[model samples]
Each structure stands twice: as C-alpha cells, then as structure tokens.
Target: MSNGEMEERIIDHLRRNGKDTALKICKALAVSRSVANKHLYDLEKSKRVKKNDGTPPIWDLMETPDDPRPVLKTDTVEKVSEIVRTGGKTGLKAHEIARDHGLTRKTVNKHLHSLMDKGEVLKTDSNQWTSTGHQDSQASGDVTVSDSVLSKCFDIIGKLGKGAYGCVYKAQHKYDGKMYAVKKVKLTGDADAEVKALAKLEHTNIVRYITCWPSSQDWESCQDTSDQSDSSIVFKGSYTETSDYDSPGMESLSISTESESPAKPSQKHRKESVDPSNPSTTYLFIQMEFCERGTLTTWIRNEKKEQRTIIEIDQIFHEIVSGVEYIHSQNLIHRDLKPDNILFGAEGKVKIGDFGLAATLTNPNGAAIYRTKGRGTRSYMSPEQELHSNYGAKTDIFPLGLIWFEMLWELSTVSEKAYLWPDLRIQKCPEGFCVKYPTEHKFIIMMLSPTPHVRPCATTIKENLDRFFSMNHMLCQKTI
Candidate 1:
C-alpha cells in the first residue's frame, strides 16, 4: 500500500518471474499499470530493476548495470519531459513519470537526471521533478518491507495463497528438510500478542506453533540464494512437493487420520522467539506445522468422491470433540469451531486451529464462565448464541452437534442405517431412538438445548462418545 511496499513487491515479482513485461506485473499484483510502472521506475532509479531492449519491453531484476554507448536517444528524454508535465505543478517522481508514459524507470530516470543537470527539468527537495518550476509535495507515512525474509531462513518452495492482507508461501526448513506453512500476517503492533497466544496453547488436538519472529528487512533484501526465479519459486531435489500446493484450501484434516498418529507439540518446539532491534517492521511471520492432507473442508468433499462410508467420519467427529474438550479444560472458549478450522494433521489425526476469536472463561478455577454474545459460523450456531445472550461452554455444543449431524448425513451413508439417525434434523425420531437409544439421543438434544444452562459441556460430550463407542463395538470393526 505504501510506495516502498509497491517497489518491494516488484522486486519479489521479478525474482519469481525472471523477465516480465510491465503488463504481467500489473495483472499479477492487481496494481494499476501506472502504479507498477512508477514503482518500477523508482526501483530503476535505485539501480534495482532493468528493462529489456525488445520491442514491447520486458522488465526484470537488474542482474548487471546497463551500458550507455549511444548516450540514450533525445526523443526518449522529451517523452519523459512530456510525462512530468501531465502531473501539473506537483510534477512527479521518476517512477511516476515512467508510469504515465509506459517507459522503463531506469531509462526515464537517466534522461530526467540529465535534464536536471542541464537546467531543463528542475529537481525538488523531496526528489520530485517538475518542468513548470513550482514545487508540489505531499507527506508520506508509507514504509517499505521486504518479501525475502523467508528466503533468508527457509528454502521457499512456492506460493500457498494471497489475500488482501498479504501472502502465504510453502517452504522447507533448510536444516531439517521438513515442510512448513509460512504465513505472512501484517503487524498492527509488535508481534508479541500472537506469540503469547500461541505459547499458552499446547495439546494434541490443537495446531502446534513452531516459532514466530519479526523480520526487519523487506522482501527484496531477504532473497534466499535457493529462490531464483521469476514465478512462484521452487527448490529442487529432495524437498517434499505436492500437486495440491497451489490450493488455498490447505487441509480438510480427515486424511490426517492416517496410521502414524498426529505429533503432539513437544516442549522443545514451544515459544521460540527472534526479536530484531526494530520491531516496527511491517510484517509478522508465523511458521506452523504443515499438514499435507489439506483442510477438513476438502476432506468432506473427498468422501463424496471416494464414496467412503460415513462410519469412519464418526471417528473424526470424536477427535474433534477431543480437541474441544482440551480447549475447555484450559479455560478457553473456541468461539469459532467448524470444519474449516478443524484441520487434519499427519497420520490422519484432527487438530483444531484458528483461535482468532477465542475468549477466556474469566475464572480459570471454576465451572462458572462469563456470558457473551455468540461468535461462530451461523449454520452451526447454538440457540443461546443466536439470541446474543450471555453464554459459555454450552455455546460450542450446538454447532458441533449440527456439524456432526451434517457429517452423519452427507459424509456417510453408514449413518443412514444406524436406525434412529435421519438424513436431516427432524423433531421426531421414527426409529424410537428416544426410547431405545435414549442416552445417545438425549445427549444430542442436550447439546441443542434452547437454554445454555441445560446444555452439556464438551467434557460431557466426550464422555458420552466414549459410551457410544462402548455400546457399539461392531461399528468400529466394519471399516469402509
């Protein structure tokens, strides 16, 4: 958003793309051609970018300096002068003029600088140039940041995702050769709060945080020697790679229910921090455990494609409840719990993540919790939550119940033959579950109870699940 950020982006883009035209840069970053061109020109003035001699003109990193033999054409100088005139009295920076006329910043700067030396174009104190002799200036608070810090630390493999805030990149630890998800979060203040939040959380059902540190350098200076390309950079050889790397839907987590079992967060991997002298740097990087299975959202869809029985999905639900239980025990409320935040880890285990909206129970030592308005996905919202009343642990009960019901219906056909379970949430139980499986149906209804006071806590849900598994051992043996 700032001038430095724009230029740093150009540097990173050129690193991945090799040699590209200005048009390609504009499209990829969604910046105006003028903005891109202006930034490119500023970078050119700093001797960081270069332009090709070809017809349409290709832009790339300045691997080497340009050779001036013919001394640059006179008409080119006049063209840059014309661009400066368009900006009125304020004139423009070298990059700004280059942007207006679709010229290389390096070429434009050369001519403009020469004109200033010869008393043709006037240079101002703010580094802006004007042909009209009047100075136009505006104060700027924008700071430039580098995209190459991950390159300095890890072997950046490729792009994971990009949004309004920043980007997520796939990377591998240079020392361990293990894969990681490098998420770039914008720092509103120092990166301490997020680090502390991640430190307080540790459990098998929770997404483990590796280490978080602030990068003082912007993207340009941090380039990894291994990341040399003009497109999404990839490190070759033995590093793990997957075809699903480009998808933003990272994990559906069901696939993580593999044989190896998800790794629990060890003491050694907790709370590692790196503090640069200047914490005012714009970006904060959080390195997290990478799950190749993708998100639970993808996992549900995979079931439909594989046509797998819903029986196994029942186990996944139990794992999810286990995660919820851990959070509750820690005196924390996972205000937002749905399939998307429910990630599948290595070895097919479920891990709850994205604690962005989580809140404390106020009293860590007792069963009493502070009541607050609801905070979670609407489809799975509890009755108490929908009313915006003061609620606690029971709030999570409703959504997890709805999700379990949906999974029972859509994620598996095995649930259909379970006798009492319906394809949808119906008021009446035709299979006489209210009488025959009275305990199971009772537990579910307690979760969806209209009053938070009557709803069962997550610990109770886990205990009830244990009962369900014990009552029907045969279902466990019949794998899809």
Candidate 2:
C-alpha cells in the first residue's frame, strides 16, 4: 500500500482500538516496525496522532473531527448491530459505538435509529442504547449467576476481607483456574487511584496486579449473599490506642488510640425507594495475586508465637524496606503504610498490597511535595501527615518506623500496645531491648522524627540495614 494509505489505516485502527504501540500496530497491519514508526511519526508531526512516552511508544489519534466522515464498508450495518447486542444492559454511547467500529458518530446514530425502527434496540433516558431483550432490561430482576459479570469470568470461592469502602473476594479464574483477590468498590472520584498505582508497579515485595473492569452493583446478590456471618470474610488484625499519654512536645499531636476493627458488610441489603429511571451504581472489580499467608499482622503474631530470633525479624523488615525503596524509585508514595496493608505472598515473600491512598510525586526528581493531610489510618500516620503540612516521600517513612517497632517488640495485648505506643514515639525503648539493639533503635528514632526533613529516606534506611547486617556477620565470623 502507498504511504498515504498506510497512515489512513493506522488512524482507522486507533479509532477502533483507542490506542496501540508501534510494535502491535506493525504486527496487526503486517508491516515492518520501521515502516510503522516512520509513518506514525509523520502523522504525529501533522497532529493527526499523539504518542505517549511509555516503554514502547503508544500511538493514538489526537482527536476526531466534529463531523466525522462515515466509515464505508459492505457489512457496516451488521458490525454496528453486533456492537449494540454485545453491550447488554449497560448499553453503549453513540461515541462508544462509533469509536469501536472506527465509524463517525453520525454514522453510528444512523444505524442506531434504524435498529430502533426495527425494535432491535432501545435508547434509555441515560442516552445509552441497548438491545431489546428481556435479559438486557434495566428492570430485569437479580442478575442470574450465569449472567453476572463476576461469575462469568471467575468462580467465586469466598470473601477475602472487607475494607472501608468495599469487600474483597477470593476467586479463581474460570479459564486459568489460578486464584486471585478481587476488590469490589463503588465507583467514585478516587476509585481508580489504586488501580493506577498498582498498574505502574511490578516488584517482588509488591502485590501483583492483574486487570480491572467495571460492573453494575448487581454482582453483590450473585455472590455468597446467604452467608451474613463475620466468618464469611477474612478476619483482620486489630489495633488499640495509647490513651492517657502526655509528652512535652507531643501534646499537639492528635493520635487515635481507639480500637479499629475491619469494616464489615451489612447482613442484608436495605430496602429503599426506587427510581426506575435511575441507573445502578457501577462498581470496579480489581483482580490481583492472592496472598494466602495473609497480612503482616498475622505474620508478626506467628513469629512472636514461634519466638523467632532478631536476625529473622531483620530479614522481614529488610524486605519491607526494599519494597518501599522500589516504590520511591518509581516516584510513588504509598501513603497508607501499616502492618495490615502488608501481606505475605505465595512463597511467603513480603508484599505491599493496598494503594488506596498512594500518590505519585509529580516532581521528576522525587522531591517532597505539598499534599492534603489526614489521609492514612490515624494510628500509623506520621505527625507531619496528621498536621496540615507539606509532605512527600517522608510521609511513608514514619509508618515504616512504627512497623519496625511492631516487629521487634511483642506488644501482644491491647493494654501493652496502649501503654508502649506513645513512649516508643519518644524513642524511649525498654531498658534491655534498647541496649541490645541500640543502632536499630536509633535508626527507628530517626525514621519517626517529628520533622519530615529529619526523617531518613527509604534508600538511606535500606543502606543502613545492609551495613549493619554486613558488620554483624563479620563479627560473628571473627568469633568463630
């Protein structure tokens, strides 16, 4: 084909698939990568397409014209009909149908109107078109197990746990048969942040992200709705506050010491007034690698019970720091850092899981930036974060300090944690433990410094641990 024809085909492909990398485009079009790149750059220069700075540059049409030209083909009508039918109850917007087939909005509307005349589809008040079928109606009763989006793709094993906003389900992929953790939460302004953060990260210490999709809230009833007991969900570890503690400089800090149990689901759905025209709230289902060993809280309890050595505890803490280092290297801050958010993966490797409050450092150099305060869990949150202050990567460091303390000491009871949590913040360690691991305690104090600037970065913390372990190993060898 001519150069002009090749560019046109590239534009058409982008319109149909939204975006693609040069390599994929070349393979799809049966053209050489060099040939595709040459034309793609030309179209980019002409402002007909745009390229994203990913590993393999992603190319997509910059924008379509106000009056798009109709895509000509012998079976255009059949294609449009198929897209509508597949859209099901959720339906498709004029633009969605148009872009899906590489056709113009006007062309898709013409086909939609024709289908309406034939009673093949109907447009809802929401301005979305859906097929005229009983199963595809808004008033259709509880979604059947076969028709539910969750059940269609996954074999629902059971509930994993509940979060502040939604519930996590343990499921097995119908095709792959591999287990996965799926989080289902109502769609909100910040609903996609976790997915975006997880998508950008891939590390041994970080949870593996699979994929995500949007589904109507109807999937709830299709799940294990019959079971309303607490046993239905995974039991999460608990935390208690250090009440009645007053320090000279720490009086201004508002640290919550109340018990924080995991959020639970309602036993039954509340019956409420229904607006037939109103649409159901959409929920986002994010699939991730399931960690059977559970959270760091469970791991810590087990280790304490087993009476593990300080050396073994250092290994776990090192792994956690390594994950934080990797996250910081990626220019991301996992604002909500705590034992509950950390998990043990398949081979019992530590993995950071929740990214609900993660923020990307817009600064290319990964410097501290101003952010809204009062985001993370109050107990594990840093003082700088508790105050209305400019924060950055250091916000994450404060929680790491608290986590390290949790690992080293055995505050197994609520009363013990309540009495010790405040003192630990002031770097007042118990007599024996402090003398034994003086270096570790000093580093922990630095990490928990009130001033964000005083706190060491994750990289520095990792290096300190590396040096300490190296020196300790050398001393042991000399004695032997």
Report the Cα lDDT for residue 380, model 2. 78
Which prediction has the highest TM-score against the true structure? 2
Q: Candidate 1 lDDT, tens digit per residue, 162-255?
A: 4334455556787888978776655432133334555678888787888765454433223334433333332111111112111122211122
- Candidate 2 per-residue lDDT, tens place, 73-157, comes to 6456767777888987789877677777677654676677656543467777456788865224323534222234565777665
| Best model per lDDT | 2
Please give the CA lDDT of all the candidate structures: 0.57, 0.68
Off by over 4 Å in 1: 1-149, 161-167, 189-194, 216-281, 305-311, 363-375, 383-389, 411-442, 475-480
What candidate 2 gets wrong by more than 4 Å, as runs, is 1-147, 221-233, 239-279, 363-369, 474-480
Query: How far does residue 317 in candidate 2 sit from its true spot (Å)?
Result: 0.9
